[model samples]
Target: MIPDMTIGQLTTEASSRWGEIWDPRATRMTILLLCPRKERKMMELHGDMIEHGQPVMAVFHRPRAEAHLLEEQGFDPRAASFQFVNIATADMGPWMQQLVNNEGWLRSSIALNPTPFSVGLPSQRPFEAVQTLCFRHPSLPALEQYFLPYPAESLPGKCFVSLPRRAAAEMARQQAEVLGVGRLEKPQPPAPEPAPEPQPAPVAEAPSESQETEASEAEEPASQTPPEDTAEPPAEEHVSVPLPPTAKPDPAPAQAETPVPLPPTPGEASTESPAEDAPGDGELSGSENIDLPEVVEEAEEISELEVELRAFFQELIDAGVEPSAFMDDPRWEDISERAVAEGLETWPILLQMTAMG
Candidate 1:
């Protein structure tokens, strides 16, 4: 049968087991055991005794661990001498239970009856497990409270610590930042850049001089797009890529047959909702083609009229128009020219006409 040693007897055995020859007065009564995994061996503690005024002890490492033990001056590799008999209660039940329950902790062949107090002995966390189990009360409230902030599985060697969600998110974000822009998805190659637009086949030089004159006038509208609507001018280093030819131009807008005269600023806004007037799912009927050009002309006419209309309305409000004279015989053509020169709209005249009739 294995000899059962009290915490005090372990002190004598620890010293004798090491074969330490010391003066009887110099033999340390207390010591720490330094073991790794299951290995052990011994050495004497003399410095702390001579220097710190503390009682010293004989220490050892498992013989099997002899080759692996460190021989540093102040380091104790084992606890071969310790008189733990004076320690009131030393139960290692909780520690053994914790180790068994926490499978990932270091392999611990727990003592059946803990007559030893190995407080200073080292393990993964020094003596935390042993001390915790020995001192921890068995009451449910005590157990629950003790385990609240830290679960046993979360103990270093224990693998059951589920990572907290916030910590996980932060870790993931940090990893993404480390990966940088290069490793990320490469923008799907941008649909092959659709191949630069075919430049209108350079307009087959017009056959006749008369046709050329018509061509010149037609060419003016192509360049007429407002500067604001086009893409911004490219900076020096970058070349401006013209839109690809694959995409077709938007179709002409539909409108009434006669040119719809511009509405006056003083007039209430047109009730038509822009969306209601927007084309829905299908192509316009063939009959609608006749009104297309007229619609385009009216649009061009509206653009020039917008600024004037706003200005003239302001003018008239300052110096009122004669209500009855507004309908005097004057063609819109003459009104158009003067309005063009003055940058005024037909709005003031329209308002007067409305007031007269």
Candidate 2:
């Protein structure tokens, strides 16, 4: 039904209404589908973005060749576990108009936990939760993953996956916990086999005490030794002990339970690159967007400026505004332009952040 709806998706032409998860952001209001890769069908959904009066985007697992396609369309696309991406950003207003007007569109975001359980939906009603869960479109693997053993009870028909942010945090926490537990359970070598053959001096001291008592008792002639020597080695202490206790817990420092890293935003490949501390680790990839210039100190300064400027502009980008509109506004452009003349080059960064079709 949204396929024919307009920006509010609730214009007078719309005869019916579907409930929406209350969100403050005016831009991203639409039903989300969690689905398998079905290019043709999803293109139809993109069509519906215009019809329904919502920006169209998708989350799917696939080859991801469509990344730049969405990127060019001004969508925020993200890669999850090398398989999935949250694609489509330009789903509102003129872009939507062009979609309905001329017709079409395209990609960002954190990784979601890849399991049956969703940590973020506990507060939601079962029906809402089902809709949220079922919103993922049915693909072969996703279908096989969710429906095989068949959680048939969970089908929130027609509802969207408006999973709350806490749910995302919970998902992150749960993922962190599993990874933590796995690292704790990993088999490790017994600690440096204790300076081989070095005598355990403590047991030696216990025997010395026992012998001195015997010697003093030998001097006491018979009385002390008779009652004491008769007592056995503390009944051999048959008390049970769990295996790991007292076994020097693998001397290696516990591997920290790091939550799966969140996916990168535009121009932020750190999440996608190798660990920062990876030794001899210079370049993560040949992507020119991240390449460094030759002059070490000077290039470093430019990189710093670039990073700062990009972040400052991300807010406008996320708002789905055009940089040219901001420039024409008179308030921001002069300051931005003057700053650019000072060698800041902030406008291009702003353009990349905002400019949409």
What are the per-model C-alpha RMSD values against the true structure? 47.2, 51.3
- Candidate 1 global TM-score: 0.16
lDDT of 1 by residue, 1-357 (tens): 012323344334534432322123442221122223222111121121122221222222122222122232232324221111111121123223442364322331211121122322233221232222211112101111111111122222211111224444455566677777334665665555577877766666549989889999998998996667768798788788897779778988986699779965643345454455556412354445556444444444555465554454444444564534433425445556767787665666566545554
TM-score, each model? 0.16, 0.16
Off by over 4 Å in 1: 1-97, 100-173, 179-186, 192-357
lDDT of 2 by residue, 1-357 (tens): 223322332322222321242223443423333323334354334543333323232322331333443345443344211221122233334323452334222121222222223433332232222222223321211321211111122222221222224434455566778788433566877787556677666643346778888889788866645564555565555888677656556688789898997867856676545565464343433343575778756544555556656765675566766665655544465556656667776656665655542
